[model samples]
Each structure stands twice: as structure tokens, then as C-alpha cells.
Target: MKIDIVSVFPEYFDVLNLSLFGKAQAKGLIEVHAHNLRDWTHDVHHSVDDTPVGGGAGMVMKPAVWAECLDELLGLEPADATPDAAVDTATDTAAGKPVLIFPNPSAPLFTQRDATELSHADHLLFGCGRYEGYDARIPAYYRAQGVNVREYSIGDYVLNGGEVATSVMLEAITRLIPGFMGNPESIVEESYTGEGALLEHRQYTKPAQWRGLNVPDVLLSGDHGKVDRFRRDEALTRTNDIRPDLIEQLGCKALDKADRKTLMALGWEVSGEHPRRRGK
Candidate 1:
């Protein structure tokens, strides 16, 4: 996969040079590039933002610099073209549009599932905004051209710019790519990948009898059959206590008859409790 990020503070991405992502890049499993948004500017100051047209607290990113940068990066003609020339170039751009977008608060909430879907794309473009925000026309222009434009948030809070948020998202998606890790099995068995409908249960180490608190005998016994059953039951028990929502989403299939009975003992109805009966 190829990802191109357009941000004013491209230097922030220097963190990517020494991590799991860096190792992945060394193996050529993916390519990641962060371009300075001001590189397309022609002026002495090389400014990228301006005061908003309407009275506002913060400045807005200018359209000219964005147009120049996007055109050069994507192989479109210069911004000074006449109407016919603009139309011709736009027609060509319609043939190859970017598949991803990072928008403001109005878009859908991002999720692990969304990251999984985006990891399969051939190309993804991240538009990072600073100060007040991007020129409103930018999103409209992309949408008119039939590109897949979407806005996503890391959480309910706001950040200084989208670069940090983009980084968070990029890391999530990159880790899911097939050859990005040394052991592919690690991805399937880790917490929250849904091999089981719960977080990774408690893990114990070499001191089987630390402080006289013994490790479960099944694990030390080397009986894989018994170990599997113990781990699943423990995971289900932990989920029922901490994240009951997961238990609710998990059908009866997630819990055997014994596990269901355990949950019921904890005052958690496995299924089919009427709304009123499920007390406050």
C-alpha cells in the first residue's frame, strides 16, 4: 500500500523513522510519505494560511497553495488555466482520484473495523489541516470529482491539527497489513482481534508458586485441551465483569452452558431479559 500525507508540519512524522513502521518500510511492505503543504507555495514567506473571509477567531488554509500542491502531486495543470483547460485537466483527474479523506467533526466516528477496511486500499491521501481549518471548497471540490471523502475522529476531544490524528490512524492500519509483522500469527491471537469476544485474559509467568499463590495446574500440566478451556473461561469471566457490553454482543455461542451459568450467578443474564426486568 502507498500512503501520501500532505501536512504543514511534515517534520512531525520523523517519529515514523524508528519503530515497527520503520522496520516495515525497510522490508518494502509499504511506502509512506509526508509532504510539506507549503512546498507548493511560490511567495517569499511561503505562507499557507490566511485570515478567514467572515470574522473568525482563527485563520484558514488558503486554496491557492493547496490547489498548486495537489495539482503538481497528482499531475494536474497549473491553477491559472482558463475554463476549458481547467475542465480538461479535471476530466483527467476523474480517472485517478484518491480513496481516503480526513475530515472535521461532522464525519462518522472511526473504528478498528474502518482501519481494517482502509488497509486494503491501493492508495490513501491524508489532508492535514492546521490553524482554523482547510478552505471549505477543498472537500466540496473532491466530492464533486467523485472521490471517496470521509472525516474521522480519534476521540471526542480536539487536537491542534490532523497530523497527530492521522498518525494514530496510520499506525492502526499499518500494523494490520499482512507482512508488516515478524510473526503473522501474533495479529490473530492478540487482544481485540475477535478470535474470542473478549480482551486477553490474565497471563501468569514462570514462578508457578509465587508467594504460595500457585499457577493454575492445567497450564503447568502441559495438557493443551484443559488449558484451552481454562483460558476461554477466564477470558469470558473477565469480560463479564469489566466490559459487559462485549458479553451482550457475544451470543450464547461465545459462552458454553457452564460459562452462561457462571455469568448468571454474577447477576448477568446471558440473553432474553426484558427491558424492565433488567433493573437499574
Candidate 2:
């Protein structure tokens, strides 16, 4: 995959050169490039922002700088032309296509599911607005040109720019790539992969016994089948106790006959009380 980031703070992307991302690049699985938006600015000060047209609280990024940077890097005209439109017209389509995204606090929340979807892209491009925000017209411009433009949010909190959010998104998606992890099974067995629930119970290496605790016997029984069953059972119990909402979301799937009986024994009911459990 190829990822191009246009940002005022291009230096912040040095984080990609050190870890798993670096390894991916070295292995020729991916290529990441960060371009300074100011490099495309024509002014003496290399200015990329201007006073808001409507008199906003902070400066807004100019469309000119973004257009020039993206156009030059993507080999397209900077005059409101969409990346996709440009690619379709060109003969060289070796690098499939790219996605245009800008992270903002007002956008829909980002999640692991989003990462999973983005991992399939041939290339991804980002425009990071650092001052107040980008000129709103760019999003509409891309949309009119048939580009898949989107706004993403990391969480409820705000950041100075989309740089950190890009890092978060990149790491999450890269980890999902095949052969990226030391143990592939770790991805499936992990929490929120299959069951959409938190991780199953865990018992770690020890002296068999800790300060005042002991590893569950099932874990040490040396029976693979029993160990798997024990882990699933514990996961059910833990999730039900601490995050019942998740169990509620799972509905009937959250409980089998044996688990339902067990819940009944613990004063739970499908209809009697515990309104949360009643409908499920």
C-alpha cells in the first residue's frame, strides 16, 4: 500500500520510520511519504492559512496550498479537479486509487472496524488542517469529482491537527495486514475480533501460584479442548458481570442452555427481574 500525507507538520511523521511501519516499508509491502504543504505555497512566507471569510476564531487553511500539494504529488491539475477524475483520465493506473480523508472532531467516531476496511486500499491520502480547519469547499469539490472523501474522528476529544489521528489510524490498520504480526492466531483469539466482546479471561505464567493466588487448574490441565472451553466460559462470565451491555447486545447468542441455567442460579432471569436481561 502507498500512503501520502500532506501536512504543515510533516516532521511529525518520523514516527512511521521506526517500528512495524518501518519493517513493512523495508519488506516492500508499503510505502509512506509525508510532504510539507508549505512546499507548494508560492508566497515569501510560505503561508498556508488566512483569516476566515466569516471572521472565525482562528485561521483557516487555504485551499490553494492543499490543491497545489495534492495535485503535484498525485499528477493532477490543482484547479478543483478530483484525484479520481484525474486518475481515470490518465493511462497509467498502476497504483489503483487513493482515498481522501481529513480527521476532525466533528466527524463520525473512528473504530477498529474502520481500520479493517481501510487496510484494503492501494493508497490513502490525508490533508491535515492545523489552524482552525480547511476550507469547507474542498470536501464538496472532491465529492463532485467522484472521490471517496470522508471525515473521521478519533474520539470525543479534540486535537491540534489530524496528524496524531492519522498515526492512530495507520497503526490500527497496519496491524491487520497479513504476516504483520508474529502470531496470526493472536488476531482472531483477541478481544473484539469474532464475538465483538472484550477479551476472554487470561491466566499468565507464574510459579503455578502467585502471592495469594493460583492459576486456574483448567489452564494447567494440559488438555487443549478443556482449556479452550474454560477460556470461553470465563469470557462469558466476565463480560456479563462487568459489561452486561455487551451481553445484552449479543442477545440470545450471549448464552447457551448451560449459561442461561447458570445465570438463573445467580438470580438472573429472562422475564422475572433484571430488566436488562428480560428482553434478551
* C-alpha RMSD by candidate, in order: 5.6, 5.0
Candidate 1: give the clashing pairs.
Answer: 103-151
Candidate 2 lDDT score at position 73: 66
Highest-scoring model, lDDT? 2
lDDT of each: 0.73, 0.74
TM-score of each: 0.78, 0.80
The deviation in Å at residue 201 for candidate 2 is 4.0
- CA lDDT of 47 in candidate 1? 96
Best by TM-score: 2
> Per-residue alpha-carbon lDDT of model 1 for 1-280, expressed as tens digits?
7778899899998888777899988888878889998888889998999999978799999988887777665555543323232223223322444564665655577777677777776677888888888898775565554455667888887788999889888888888889887787877645556533576678889889999799988899888978887887777678767877666666555557777766666666656531111454
Model 2's number of clashes is 0
Over the full model, what C-alpha lDDT does candidate 1 score relative to the true structure?
0.73
lDDT of 1 at 273: 35
